[model samples]
Target: MVRAPFLFALLAAAPASFAQQATLSNGTMHVQEGTTLRFTGPLQFTIGPAGALINDGLIDLGTQAVVVEPVGSPISGSGVEMAVTATDGPFNATAPGGLGLSLTTNTATGPITVTRGHLARVFPEGDPSIARWFRLEAPGGGSAPVDVVLSYDATELNGLSGSAIGLYQSTQEDGPWSSLASTNDAAQYTVSATLPAPWDFITAFDQDAPTASASLVARNGVEVWPTLTHGPLFIQVKDGAALEELDLFDGLGRLVTPAMHQRSSTFASMDLSGLANGPYFLRIGQRTTIKLRKE
Candidate 1:
């Protein structure tokens, strides 16, 4: 019943290396804020029934396997609790090949494990850009919703831009994958989403398709360029009239205001970097509403 904070609590021998495997039979393990607990190698790390992990820091399991055994004896009907908080920092868990998870969850009924790999090579229902998957397993599920942040590499985009990426989840490995309302950080190559319940499989997909170079159209003395823009959108007034008012609407016609917008007498630009990839309607002053796309 030793209650040490981190790695020292488990391995009292030599420095943990790639050849060793750490097993926790029982007791609560805590990873304090700003600290990182990493386990690397081909061996498996197991946490038995009487064991628990409370992580508020980063846990890097580079190509390693972590098994959280189920607590058959549910204490007061609550089996085992493993709370992972990822909102405070960058991300909590990271695996090989650019798969990461910043998960927020409550108690679990059974074993919980994370594996990196693709469930299917090609999913025709969603983005065909990338095919990597991160599978999280929790038998009976948890209490609160889980926030997930997945990072990716530009090479894996399959010719798609990073800003056009989003998260998609499916209960099974095969078909019927649904898109999640996620925010993409093109600079960091990360996509984030909040799942109401536990999902079996999650992957990154490109929600916006590439448009032809001729999509840019100008009318009524108002001009916009590179219709398929990655971030900054430029607007110019051909007649040199004040741009007056400007507004943006999403695919559903929902009004969305850009966080970074600058305007002068006849020229203006909006930073569409934080926006999702889709078709949007940009309204300029009165009587001029041009259609555009954001990637």
Candidate 2:
């Protein structure tokens, strides 16, 4: 179906899905706040010139793609969005692969275009397994810091540890890849990173593990292992130090009572199977806080 000025304002508890290919040839398509517009099925969405997408709710593209022709009205507004899983291949104009990557812009000057490909980029630090490179741009070539959420599939890791993988950004496609301080969800197989500036390319790479000695000491002589843990979180004290008390806090700083935790003079293990997947803080007695992630 085609709507010149497609204004979708929904109030139902469930989201509405577009099962077939839809086209917004002209005017604007506004998704009102609190609603969800999900695109499903094996078809693509086309937004032509003079056509815009203003999302105030959720625009969920589940394994689907959108084609926003150049000079087309841009996708603007502060809202939630979801992307598709990337595939290895050339840039398919009908379905460019910015898979599992979502962007939130505070101030958008024009439409945003994201494309993913295997462009043979250089990673001087190391190589990425099953890497799918992504490129993002908008009208008039821009500049601004933006927060991005990117995801990966377990199968894509290709025998690499999920926690060891991180998002790497580069100014050019060929050389010098820098690691971003990323918040990795070991359980969910996703990573979140902030782009301090405009980047030419971004992809995920497996980072080298720290030396054994460095890994053995976290802070205040406390050792925390597998910052990204699936269930149990291991803690150890060094230099003949003893752990006084252990306190667990959620990402919001709210105290969380761990269902199972055992502590000795030098070692302890906390059961994280009961907690949700996300970031957390593990307090080792007084004056020390070690960050932990449960996936």
Candidate 3:
């Protein structure tokens, strides 16, 4: 059976704005070839093999992460392409490999506006070797920050235990590059940081090791084992106080494991076989949170 492509069009003639949250549960939301769609709140959309989101307008994702999922599509493997024309002012584009590139306001206080025809050029004579390059303009006299998140595939990164990645920012795009503070989420294959200033171009590459290591401390007589693991995770509490509640959350801040009660025991384990390979957080009691990885 042939499935017709689902299309949601926003024409320039109509010129609409979504002040609250909206979702495109299933289907493609096409921002017509020459039109614009402004989103003040969160905008969630799903892209499948037969669906796509082509934006040629000003989209403001606000403070929320734009969730992009591929249903029955190769988006998670090969990735999708988002072209920002020269006229498109300040737009953000995130790829399947967990790469989020965006040009937003300086304050980081307002919405990110992407105007049409705002083409970002590769720095330093447009190097052909660079896999991806983007150019962003600072809002007039004020400066803006360029944010970059380098995400890797868990299977390919070897469970994020021995892999290292770095994010570099450059003003000339080819001259000298400055390194930024990046947090590695081993479980989920992502390293991200925000550049302090507006640079010509920002890029990410692998490193020998992470700049900062995950800290393991004994809090409230409880300690989590194998900060980095490819299988089930173990937690132990020295004092035989039963855990009031336990919770597990994915990198995107979604709760993967529901709150559960545990009897007074020194040791407990949770199987991660059902969850996708990535970084997760295990919260014990009410405050202690530990990072865990699944391969």
* Winning candidate number (lDDT): 2
**Predicted candidate 3 versus true structure: per-residue lDDT over 1-295, tens digit per residue:** 1123564333233213322333343455545434534333333433444554544443433333243434323122111233222332343543311124534333442332221122222222121112333333334412556455554334333222423544545555453334455676666655667765544555443433221223343566787656555555667777777654777766544578632233345667767777777655566755365545565
Q: Would you list the rank order by lDDT, best first?
A: 2, 1, 3
lDDT of 2 by residue, 76-130 (tens): 4545455543432222232322345666546643444564543234342234443
Judging by TM-score, tell me the better candidate of 1 and 3: 1
TM-score of 2: 0.41
lDDT of 2 at 131: 40
lDDT of candidate 1 over 12-90, digit per residue (tens): 3423543444666666666555666665554345566666555545456544434333433111111121222212222
**Model 3 alpha-carbon drift over 4 Å, by segment:** 1-4, 7-43, 46-50, 54-67, 71-162, 172-177, 208-295
- Candidate 3 contains a number of clashing pairs equal to 19
Please give the RMSD to the true structure for each candidate, in Å. 16.8, 17.1, 17.7
lDDT of 3: 0.44
Clashes of each: 0, 1, 19
Residues forming the 10-long window of minimal summed lDDT in candidate 2: 88-97
For each candidate, the alpha-carbon lDDT, in order, equals 0.57, 0.57, 0.44
Q: Quote the RMSD, in angstroms, for model 1.
A: 16.8
